[model samples]
Target chain A: MNRRKFLKQSSIISLGLLACPSLSSAFSLGANNDVIIGHNSHKYKVDLTWGNLNPLHTPVNDCHEMIQDSKGRIVLLTNHTKNNVIIYDKSGKLLETWGTDYPGAHGLTLVKENGEDFLLITDYERHQIIKTTIDGKVVFTIEYPAETGKYTTKDDFKPTETAVTENGDIYVTDGYGKQYILHYNHKGELLNFFGGSGTEDGQFLNAHGICYDNRNPQNPSLLVSARELNVLKRFDLQGNFIESFNVPGALICRPVIHKKDIYFAVLRSKSAINSDSGFILIMNENNEVVSCPGATSPSYQNNKLNELYQTVRLFQHPHDVCIDDDENMYVAQWNSGKTYPIKLTRV
Target chain B: MRKFIGIIIAMLVFSSCEKQQKEVTSFLQQGEIKLTNPRITVSNTLIDSFVTLKPEIHMEKLSVGYEENGKTPTEASTKLHTTISATKPGIYKFRAFHPDWKPSEVTSIKLYKKGHIPNKITWKTSANKKYKGQGETTLINNQKASLEFRDIEWVGFDTIAKATVSFNRKTYIKSLTISYLTDPKSWVFPPASVTLYLNDKDTINVTIPALTEKEIVKLDDIKIPIEKEISTIALKVNNVQKLPDWHAGKGLKAWLFMDEWIFN
Candidate 1:
């Protein structure tokens, strides 16, 4: 549990020892109402008040995604032009805010190079991927790959996410437009492109997210999220289709890896417009779903996973999740009435 | 009594040593906890033999109560712990119940028995190009679409959609039921009115009320009782020409979606 909850429970127990019989029952009830969510070994206590700020100054619209910098501070990205990036300490205190130019800031990724932190922000409206320092200074920008010959114009390339390998090779997923994975070098030169919109094993429908999986360290690959198809496809670094698996009933937004586990923020259950149908899914190193935070417990039969869906209305359109050093999760939402990120403290 | 007082003093001393965190209030509590509606699933609502409805709720300390005769389900209704076997066609309503939390809103579905199969069907006006599903055969195909308006079974019209059901011979029919999808969030609403022409002679007109606000996505069945036995029926369904000012699509025309037409 987080430090704040630990102190509160400690005080409550200390007071309960000397309180009257009637008051002790109320104390126990208050402790039980901590509102824990998730299942099995991945349960968490809900912290709804995390990262809340005054809307007049730090207003946010469509909290798209979040990540943790090397300084151990939580960074949030939103589409609202007023304050595109908001930094906060682990205890939910606002540290700083910047960037009024990113009107369509959708994806945020942090990469460390030479002991310095850099952020890769993907703006779908601008159709560009920008690299910036931790404090909001633009280092360089990568425009739409016109030389790839696959895209006719800049409007046909709407990049949603970018994954950087250890050697500085960048992989971008054009999720909203042509649904192709564009591979580029560190100098923003397009190398190869593949995976157009199709139902075949090599193609993708809505390749919403991409992540470089280095769990094995020797045989690293790229994991892409096919949101509409409810499948996760694995491809070798050279962009060859290795295999794919289904998470049946989930519209996963992205795959965030930490240690031996993979986490995802399911945008919705079945239909895109099905309001308040979002949840969080967790998978172990073996590529098996072990727990669903706001949904049903994971169960498999005959090597086929059961169709997973939301069981509680704790979240609405959870777009992304960021795991901190303490293993706590910060959830950013999309299209869910302008609200702040919610913190889930692992128990 | 003296020892109890001493113990209370020591407890206070130890509690004061611990640091107190800031008092932060979450805005989530503004919306009180309300149980989500239970999901009711069946293979097909258009049944020839019998249909089994499986009502599911995964939360603990919650029970699902349902009614089969179209009445609103309440806490005192029959607790549905297992699947419901229905041998006849009727409306089924369900709601989730908990002792501490607010009860969920009611969700209902309709089941229709096998009806007269039309030998031929034709539409006077075509549906919107984006949502035309297999032409006129979709109405008599007996396949019902889910709440999603994009389903292949739904044929949506932006204007008045008229269809004629004809049989090889004069077939006796008692009533006609029209199954349509309602998802107000997507600007899909029920038809404003329906006009039924029996054998191109007698006319039956029914006016549908507009929705006051957004509602859940569900397929609703509206039954038109016709006691007069008829062979050929001409059905006309009208779309909402202009949405209400309260709606986001205030001046735009709302879509009218139909999946099936059951003739009993």
Candidate 2:
């Protein structure tokens, strides 16, 4: 059918559902249940009640990254149509949106230091790392360096995620097009680059995510998430391999650090959808699974309602995750048929 | 009686002086000509078609004289024309309505002494292709490809001479068209094969199975053709498969080529 006919049919269907409460509730997970969190901290059993954050009216597509700003406001980065980076607040209110300029924004990070918050973003289309202010003002921009001999052709360069150190050193993962971890000094200078596209012990198939670990204040390590390989490889501040572990999920997007716990948002294959429901796996300092919220098996009936209530919880494709200082979890999801960023507060 | 006579003499002198001042003002007003035309036709040749016309009135008092390449004109028509003449190949402005009424739209008469001719057409190849310059054949992987022509004079319906290019081997020609140029509607291509690529180890071998007599055509006019001295034609090879190589080396060196080259 033509676009007009499709739109007309969709509108009619939507209007019909609006008239019927039960039909609308069954079809839409947002309209029926409010943003719910696991309320009881002691038992760790989530009630799934509507939280303060409202549901966004428009459906989100490929939400790759999210971050909470200095003002306790949640900023989501999505691969919206035509390179638009939409920003939404924690209350599910459409705050302000900008950035049609960077069409392939796949990763976003908010770095706060010295009473200032900066937005560090990566564009797969432009194959570059960009630094902007909290309000979307560009502060620094760096393109893929030609010195990295990994690229046989210019088009083979795509930077996925960015992590900034306390001292302002920036690390970008060339995940989509190229497989390399690029590091730059605080002044936007190319300090060094290591790691190429591979499936070896230290190499990467898709170096999808990166983060600066300040857990050891004296010596900080860089955590790189290799999605396709289903492993999180820990590296030294200078890009040296330290250790690697198998992530519980098939497609691991991003890993967040909260206090002494590390949380990763994982997407399950269709076979593992219901039984092994997609959820955030939290690991303690000993690298042991402490909390597994949502579902642990591939049973559809057990996780269906849980998946329906919080689509991000049964995440068909969870792209990125971050933890605020308050220990609240923010997740960016893709292929969930919704556009709003998901927020999960720790019980 | 004597006082009355002195008063009359003083009045006569004052009248004479006022008459002389009025004559001078009239001369200034008559010397200036107000151009009413506003629009000047832009020809392809001239970069600046500004009119140089001087107003008969004072420069500060002139409201219709040429101001910044014929944007503002003065009330004096003669001065406006004179200033317009100073600029070679100028445009003249005429008022569409009276001064008391706001002019609807200014009209201009373009003075084009000679017609302009476009530069000679040139060609360029993809940077990945080894060949460069016109009529040079480059090997491109079999896919949807393009050959660009630049610097050609844009004549609405005029046709340029076509050159015949033939490939020795059977190759699938997906698309033949021009990019970054005007008249997308006039793009044309030759017919070839679709599934040209077969199973190969190093490179996906895409051989043109057969060639048809049908010609491909595309016409788009919204794009402004490039004016560079050189343009490029691209032969694209697509649908390449990566073969399993036991070597530990990185990246595969693939080959795809165009057997013949031509321009018409």
TM-score of each: 0.85, 0.46
**What is the two-chain DockQ of model 1?**
0.27
lDDT of 2 by residue, B1-264 (tens): 544554554455455445544433321122122222232222321223432333322112223333334553444433332333433544545432223223323434333222122122222223222222223222111111222222122111111112223334333432232211111112222112122112111112223322122221111211112222222222233211321143222133222222222121
Give me the candidate number with maximum DockQ. Answer: 1
| Per-residue error (Å), model 1, residue B188 | 5.1
Chain A TM per prediction: 0.92, 0.76
Q: What are the per-residue Cα lDDT tens digits for candidate 1 across B1-264?
A: 644655665566444322111121232231245566677777788888888888776767778899989999998999988787887788888888865456877877788897888998888999999998866798899888877788899999999999898888887788888888888878899989999999989999999888775646767767899877677889999999999888888999999999999988
- Could you give candidate 1's per-residue lDDT for residues A223-272 as a string of tens digits? 99999899999999999999998898898988999989999999988752
Highest lDDT against the true fold, candidate: 1
Candidate 2, B151: how far from true, in Å?
Answer: 60
Alpha-carbon deviation at B143 in model 2, angstroms? 43
lDDT of model 2 at position B226: 22
Model 2: CA > 4 A from native: A1-59, A81-83, A269-277, A297-313, B1-264
True contacts kept of each: 0.12, 0.00
Worst 10-residue stretch by lDDT in candidate 2 chain B? B151-160
Poorest lDDT segment (10 consecutive residues) of candidate 1 chain B: B18-27
